[model samples]
Target: MTILLVEDDEVDVMNVKRAFKKNNISNPLVVASNGIEALEVLRSVSPDRPRPKIVLLDLNMPRMGGIEFLKEIRQDPELSSLSVFVMTTSNEDSDKIEAFNLNVAGYILKPLSMDRFISAVSTLNSYWTLCEFPG
Candidate 1:
């Protein structure tokens, strides 16, 4: 299954790509710079390009943020069931609480170190491999 990564920072996007490569994650990784673009991509799913099995989202962005994206999706019946994991720099309790309230699958804090970041991605890779997702 494909994985969607919604992040505005180019550096963070590169980091995720690097981590996926290091972890030997073969899933096709699609990217969107912001929540608005992400929703556009998700809604444009076709037989050739299926919807992402999960979304790895960043909280802060220019046009639309992760929290807003979560709220929007949760309110739409067609998108509400999409599995989303918050992978962001925000470590505040409020952010975590709000994310959980919106029914996010998991909330992950971005690691400062490259090694730790790769380790976290490796763990996520393993988790997705073990879990069965709906089509």
Candidate 2:
């Protein structure tokens, strides 16, 4: 399964990559620094290449933010069914509620420790590997 990670922090991106490596999740990982770039990538998915099965997004970004990205996805008929999960450091209740309202697949707080991050990635990997995709 291809995973698209949308985050602005380089450190966080490296850490997540490491965690994925540690967990033996070998799917081709694509990354977008912010929401705008993510939109471009999503727009480029075609029948020849399957759309990303999951998107790991961060709420805070330079250009368009995660919420804005979600709104765009919801508004686009071609991409409305795409699954996205907000994995961010923001712990505010409002953020969580808004993400849920936007129909996010899951909201996960970024784990601080490497071990925990690895575990989290492992669980996510298992989920994607086992979950059935809709036709």
Candidate 3:
């Protein structure tokens, strides 16, 4: 499964990568620094490669933000059904509600500990790996 990680912070990105590595998730991972970059990656198509199966999004970003990004994706006919999960540091209830309203698959609080981070990644990987998809 291809995964797109949309985060602006370098440290957060590195931590996520470490978690994925610890969990042994071998899917080709893609990085997007912000909402605009994420949109470009999501809409891009390849003749021989499948689109990203999941998007791990961060709420705070420059140029564009996560809620706005979600709105854009929801408005697009082609990308409306794509799975997006919020993996952000923000614990705002308003943000969570808005994300759910916009059809986010899940909202995860960023874990502070390395072990918990790995566990979260493993759980996410397992959930997506077992989910049914169009053939």
Candidate 4:
């Protein structure tokens, strides 16, 4: 399954890539720096650009944040079923509540250490492998 990573931080983005490489995850990965860019990529008709089966979203970002993006996607018929996992540093209970309200598949706090990050991603890789997506 293809994975879309929506993050604005350069270091975090690189870390995700490293984690993917370390886990031997060969699924195609697409990156968008923010909600708007992510939406654009998701809506694009380019055949070469594969649609992601899952999205890894960050809660804090410019233009539009994760909650707002979740609201947008959950409201759209075309995108409503897209599985999303919130990956953020925000530990606020309200944020977690809001994300769950919008039907995110999972909510994961960003780990501070590279090893933990890899472990999280590795676990995620195992998760989607067991999932069956609608075509």
Candidate 5:
């Protein structure tokens, strides 16, 4: 399954890439800078390129943040039920509550070390592989 990563930080994006490689996660990855761009990418999916089975979302962004994006998608019938995992630095209980309320699959705090990041990515890889997803 394809993976869509909606993050604004360039360094974090790069870290994800590196972690994926280290974990041997060869799935195709698509990147978006913010929630707005992420919505555009999701909407553009077609039969040839289905919507990503997983979305790694960041909560804080310049335009539409993760919470707003989740609300928009959950309201849209065509986009609802998307598997979204919030990967953010925000430790606020409110953010976590809101994200869970919006039906996020999981909420993960970004790891500080590269080793931890790689381990986290590996866990994700294992999770998706063990689970079934709609095509």
Candidate 6:
């Protein structure tokens, strides 16, 4: 399954890629730098392009943020069922509440250390491997 990672930081993007590689996660990963770009990618109807099975979203971004993106998708009939997980730096209660209210599958705080981040990714890899998603 393809995972869409929406993040603006180049370093963070590289870290996810590195962690996936290190963990031997062979699933295809698609990237979008911000919420708008992510929407464009998700909304595409290209026959050959695979839809992302999940989204790893960052709350703070240019143009549009994660919360707004969640709202947009939830309101759209075709996209409402898509699974999303918040992988962000924010630890605020408001952010957490809002994310849950928007129906995200999970909320994860980005670890500052590389090892912890990789471990988190590995856990997600294992979890997804055991689950079945709608096509």
lDDT of each: 0.92, 0.88, 0.90, 0.92, 0.92, 0.92
- In the range 36-103, model 5's lDDT, one tens digit per residue, is 99999999987888788799999999889999999999999988978899999999999999999999
- Report the lDDT tens digits of candidate 4 across residue range 1-135: 789999999999999999999999999889999999999988884667668879999999999999999999988888899999999999999999999999999998986688888999999999999988997
Worst window of 10 by summed lDDT in candidate 4: 44-53
What global local distance difference test value does model 4 have?
0.92
**Candidate 3 lDDT score relative to the true structure:** 0.90
Model 3 poorest 10 in a row by lDDT: 44-53
Give the distance in Å from residue 88's predicted Cα in candidate 3 to where it truly belongs. Answer: 1.0
lDDT per residue (tens digit) for residues 15-108 in model 6: 9999999999999899999999999999995778877878999999999999999999999998898889899999999999999999998999
lDDT at 32 for candidate 1?
A: 98
Task: For model 4, state the Cα shift of residue 34 in Å.
Answer: 0.7
lDDT of 5 at 42: 92
The collision pairs in model 2 are: none
TM match of model 4 to true structure: 0.96
Q: Which tens-of-lDDT digit does each residue in 8-49 have in candidate 1?
A: 999999999999999999999999999999999899989999
Against the hidden reference, what TM-scores do the models get? 0.96, 0.93, 0.95, 0.96, 0.96, 0.96
**Model 6: residues with Cα > 4 Å off, grouped in runs:** none
Compose the digit string of candidate 2's lDDT tens values, residues 1-135. Answer: 678999999999999899988988889889999999998888897787667768999999999999999989889988788778899999999999989998998888985688888888888888788888776
Q: Can you tell me which runs of candidate 5 are displaced by over 4 Å?
A: none
- What lDDT does model 1 reach? 0.92
